[model samples]
Target: MSLFLTLKVALRALIRNKVRSILTMLGIIIGIAAVIAVVAVGQGATVMIQEQISSMGDNILMIFPGSASSGGLHFGAGTRSTLTPQDAEAIMNECLYVKAVSPMVRAGGQVIYQDKNWSTSVNGVSPSYLEVRNWELKEGAFFTDSEVKAASKVCVIGATVAKELFDTESPVEKTIRIRNMPFKIIGVLVKKGSAAFGQDQDDTIIAPWSSVSRFLQRGSFNSVNQLLVSATSIKTIELAKTDITSILRQRHKLSEGTDDDFSIIDTAEITKAITATATTMTMLLAIIASISLLVGGIGIMNIMLVSVTERTREIGLRMAVGARSKDILLQFLVEAMVLAGIGGVFGIIIGGSTAEIVARYNDWPVLVSAQSTVIAFLFSAAVGIFFGFFPAWRASRLNPIEALRYE
Candidate 1:
């Protein structure tokens, strides 16, 4: 028999038991849908993480005070205030690969405007802080070097703070009290959603380091909490780190074999760590989802076996009428493929819709690629062939006399 006639016969056979055929394809449909949806969600999460990491800064490095040891016990990083504003200036002036540097002093207090009060972090930094952090002003300008030197009570509010305090009104030129001291709002930072660690990026306030040290917190004027360093380019980040470390060691006068009093955090390293974690999670989820496909293949094999047993006498009739065994095998194989192929097509449609619905409901990112869809369809077809072969071969090899004589 020709391929077309075989397919028509196989299709007719399936149509005769419509409910059974549909039930048999249910497993394939569910399996393919699940795999596609899981993959799409995983890919979306990975992309979202990468974007968050990139938004932190371009070729940035953070320098923090190293841990201090006392009584054989060691404190964590940032426990000491060994970093200073002078160190930041020296890095910009001496480090050839360094593009910009900012000294940071951190404090926390309630910000009061009119009758509303919101507690938030108050960071003391110079004008270069914005440049190093790749932050932009939404309403006003940053404080100048002279203002930082004079310990002026001028500040920049982030989007979250502005919204909390002023609502729809602009916060520039407004007076807000931090730590019971009034500060004139000089600028408002553009909105930055959130950090990679889930911290709210737009929930703090920025001011001169001198002001924060003098009025907001009781600390030495020369001491700073951290330094934000921007490299000339991504290619120069490592070189910049090396140069900064050497310069700081010399400035701090640390001898050989002595532990330095500072720690450097490269944005590239953070990005790599985050990407690695996301990739691992995606693969894990994909692997778990794949098990459903295997289960579905087993379902196909079981159903095909029942189909062969039910149609034993029909097979005997065909073989007795000169129909070749290979023809019988081909017809059954094509029927299985047709079932799987149709299920796959429907599964893709359902999966894409499911992914979109999930993304919308959860406000998450989802990407459905053409490549994944094609792979899923091809895999389904392969599963059908592998699982259906045994039952098909059994049907072809049946003894015609015994089949005809059976009740």
Candidate 2:
């Protein structure tokens, strides 16, 4: 028989048991939908993480004081105050690959404006802090180098702090008290939602490092908590790190054999680590979803076996009337393919809708690519062929007399 005739016969057979055919396709539908939805969600999370990291800065690097050992015990990084404003200045003046640098000193206190008081971290930094952090002013200008040198009580508030303290009002040119000392609010930073670690980025205050050291922290005037540095470009990040390390070691009078008193972190390293983790999670989810497809294929094989058994006498009658074995195989194979093909089409529709709904409900990003949809459909068709072959061959090989004699 021709391919078209075999397909017509298969369609009639499937239509005779419409309910059974629909039930057989259920597994394929669910499996494809789950795979597509999981992949969409995983890709969305990866993109979100990259965006958050990029908002931190452009080619940024952070320098923190190294750990100090006491009584044969070692303290963690940032436990020592070995980093100084002079070191940051030297890096800016000497490191060729460095673009900008800022010295930072941090303290925590209650900020009071009128009757409103909100406790937040106050970061004292040089004017270059904004440039190094890639932060922009929403209202007014940043503080100057002279202000930092004079330990002026000028500050910039983050979006969260501004909203909490002033509500709808712009915080520029206003005054707020921190640590019982009044500070003029010179600027408001543009909103940054959150950091990778889930800390609120726009929930603090910024001021001159000199002011924070003198008034809030009461620590050594020469010491800074950390240094924020920006490389000229991404390509120069490693070079900048090496140059800064060499410069700091020389400034700190570290010998060739001695350990350095500071640590430097590259933002690119953090990005790589986070991306790797996201990729692994996506692969795992995809693998788990694929197991359902395997199960669906098994269901198709089982259903086809029952179909061949029930149609044994019909098969014998067809063979006795001069039907070829290849024709019988083609008919059953086409039936299975039709079932899987229809299921795949519906699965794609359901999966795309599911992904969109999940993204909307969670306020997440999702991307549904055409490539994934096509691949899913093709895999379903392949599953049909692989699992339908054995039953179809068995039906085609049955002896006409024996099949006709069966109940």
Candidate 3:
């Protein structure tokens, strides 16, 4: 029989048992849907992480005061009190690959705006802090170099702080008291919701580092909490790191092989680590989903075997007439593939809808790429062929006389 006739016969056979055909395709549909949904969620999560990290800065690297291990003892960030504003200035003046540097001094206090007061973090930093962090102002302007030089009590409030303290009022040109010292609110930072690790991105205030170090911080006058550094560009990140390491070590007079007093957190490295973790999770889920696809293929094979037995006399009559063995094999194979293909189509629709619903409800993202969809459909078809082959071959090899004589 011709290819068209084989397809017509196979489809007719499937239509004759619609319920059974649908039941057999269930495993495949469930498996494909699970895989697609998993992949879409994973991709969306990775993108969100990247966006959060990118919001932190352009070629950003944070310099904390101490390493995980320092002086043969455990020391976490800001514990050593080794970094100073002078060191940040040195990096800015000496490192060619460094684009911007902001020495940060952190303090916690209640900010009082009229009758309303909100407890929030206050950061002392230079005007360049916004540039290094790639943050923008929603209103007014950042403090000037003269304000930083003079340790002036001028400030920029984050979106959270503004909302809590001033509500709908634009915070610009307003005054708020921090630790009993009044600070003029010069700008309101644009809202940045949260980090990948769930830290609130905008719940603080920015002021001159000089002011924070002079009046707010309790310890050494010269020391800063951290240094926010930005490389000239992404391509120069490693070179900037090397330059920073060498300059800081020489200034601190560290010996060879000794761990440096400072710790550098590379935003790019953090991105890679997070994305790798997401990809691993996605792959594991896909593997688990594939088990259903295997079970579906097995069901198809079992059903085909039963079909061959039940239609043995029909098969015998076809062969006795003029149908070739290859024709008989193709007909059965087409039926299995068509069954699987239809399941795959349905699976794609359900998977996409599931992903969409999840994203909508959770305020998350979902990316159902075209490449993943095509691969899933093709894989289902391949599963059908591999499982259907044995039954098709068995039916094609049966002796016509024996098949005809069988009850």
Each model's lDDT comes to 0.88, 0.90, 0.88
| Candidate 1 per-residue C-alpha lDDT over 93-169 given as tens digits, one digit per residue, 9 for 90 to 100 | 99999888999999999999999999999999888888788889998989999999899999999999999999999
Order of models, best TM-score first: 3, 2, 1
Native-to-model Cα distance after best TM-score fit, residue 100 in candidate 1, in Å: 3.1
lDDT tens digits by residue: candidate 3, 180-296: 889999899999888768888899999999888887888787889889999999999999999999999999999999888998888999998999998999899889888888988
Q: Give the number of the best model, judged by TM-score.
A: 3
TM-score of 2: 0.88
lDDT of 2 by residue, 1-407 (tens): 98888888888988899988888898888888888888887877887788788788899999999998999899999988999999998999999999899998999999999999999999999999888989998989899999998999999999999999999988898999997899999889999899777789999999999999999996888899999999999999999999999999999999999998999998888999998999899989989998997888788888999999999999999999998898888888888887787877887789888998888886767777788889889988888888888889998999999988779
Local error of candidate 3 at 337, Å? 1.1
Candidate 1 has an lDDT of: 0.88
Cα displacement (angstroms), candidate 1, residue 254, comes to: 2.4
Model 2 pairs whose backbones collide: none
